[model samples]
Target: GGGKPLAPKNANNAAKNSLRVADIGAGTGNLSIMLLERGCEVVAVEPNDAMREIGISRTKDKNIKWVRATGLESGLEDSGFDWVTFGSSFNVMDRSQALKESHRLLKPQGYFSCMWNHRDLNDPIQEVAEEVILELVPNYTRGVRREDQRPVIEQHKDLFDTIIYIEEDFYFHQNIETYIAAWKSVKNPYWDLETSEGQELFDKIAYQMRHKLPSEFDIKYTTRCWSAKARN
Candidate 1:
C-alpha cells in the first residue's frame, strides 16, 4: 500500500483564518489544491506556460484563479492578500525582492509561509543518490543548501517576525518510475543536459537502485516551515 503523504502543516494553519491566499510558483497547483480544500480563495501564480496549463487543468473548479506571474511581478493588487505562500519554490526567488513583494501584497497581520521538503542525507540511499547526481551532472547547483535557513531568516528580519516549525522523519515511498519522473521534474541541472544523455544517466541510476534495493523504496525527509505575520 502507498504511504500517507505529509502535508504542510504551517500552510494549513495559515489557511484557517485567511480569506485570500496566493501560492507563488505553484507548479501544477499541488499546494493550491490543499488551500482550496481548506476553503481559502487561492490564486495559483506560475511563470511557465506548461506549468500554468497543468495547474489550470488540475484546478478546473473555477475557485482557483490561475495567473501567469513570478515572485517579482505577481500582478496582484497591493495589500490584496490575507496570506502568501511558497511551497518548494522559495529558493528560485530573489530572496530580498520576493520578501519585499510578499510583504507588499499582504494586509496587516497577513501571514507568509514558506515550506520545503528536504531530503535526509543521513540515509545511505539518499546519500548515494546525492553523490551520483553530483558526479554525473556537471555544474550542479544544489538549489538551496540545508544550512540556508539562518541566513534567509536573518535577511528578512525586518519584514516579519519568524516562527519556525520542523516535521522530521516524514516518509515518502516511490516506485522506480515515479521516483525518476519526480526527480527529473525538479532537477535543474539535469534539464540542461541533452535529452539523450539525461535519459542515459536516469536509466543507469534507476537500474543501479533497483539492483541495490529490490523491495519497497522508502525515504525520509524533513519538512521545514517558516511563517510570520507581516510587520506593520
Candidate 2:
C-alpha cells in the first residue's frame, strides 16, 4: 500500500494544551516533523537504528529528541508527556500494554492518539495489490484489522471518557515512477521481498498496472485516527 500523507486536523488543539509530546514508534519522524513544525516540544521513540538515523538526519534543524525504545518501555519519565501519538505504529506493539504505558506517561487530561494510512480495499487496484501481497507473503501478519477499532475503543473506554474515532478516505495522484518509489519505502513484507522471484513478481505487477494507467493513477487511501484523553 502507498504511504499517504496524513491529513491536517485539530491535532494542534491537543498539542497546544500540552507542554511536551512524544511520538511512539516514529519511523523516520514523519508525524514528528509535523509536530515540530507546529512548535511542539517533541521526542521520538524509535527502536530501529536505521529508521532513527533517517529521522535524525531529516529533522536536523528541528528540535526532536530521538530515543531507541519500544512501545511498552519508552524509557521516559512517568507522567512525562502531555500528548502521546502513534502514527502507523500502534499495530506493531502489544496494544493493551502500550495503552497502559501511554496512560502511565500521560498527565491528567493528556491525549493519546493513533493514526494509520490504510489502503482502501474497495478500490480495485488496491484490492489487487493486497491480494498480491497476501499471496506473496502468506506468513505476514495482517496488521490492524479494520473492524476491531471499535472493540479496542470499548476496551479502553474507562481510561478515556471523551473519545473521537474517525475514518476518512483520501486520494493521492502519482505517476508510475513515483508509485514504485513509494512502494519501495514500505518495510516488512515489501522489504522482505528482496529476492529475485519477489522482484520479478513486483515488476510484473507494476508492468501490468502501468499498461492500465493514463500517464498517472489515483491511489485511494483510508486514514483511520482515534484520539482519547486520560481521565483525571
TM-score of each: 0.79, 0.76
lDDT (tens digit, per residue) of candidate 1 on 1-232: 2211233346556445546888999987878998887667888889878778988988896567988888789999989987889888877877778888999999877778788777888887677776666666656666673445546656777887755555556888877666665675573555533478777877776666665553557878887877777877
Local distance difference test scores for all models: 0.74, 0.75
| Over 4 Å off, model 1 | 1-18, 138-141, 187-190, 193-216
Error in Å for residue 217 of model 2: 2.3
Question: What's model 2's TM-score?
Answer: 0.76
**lDDT leader:** 2
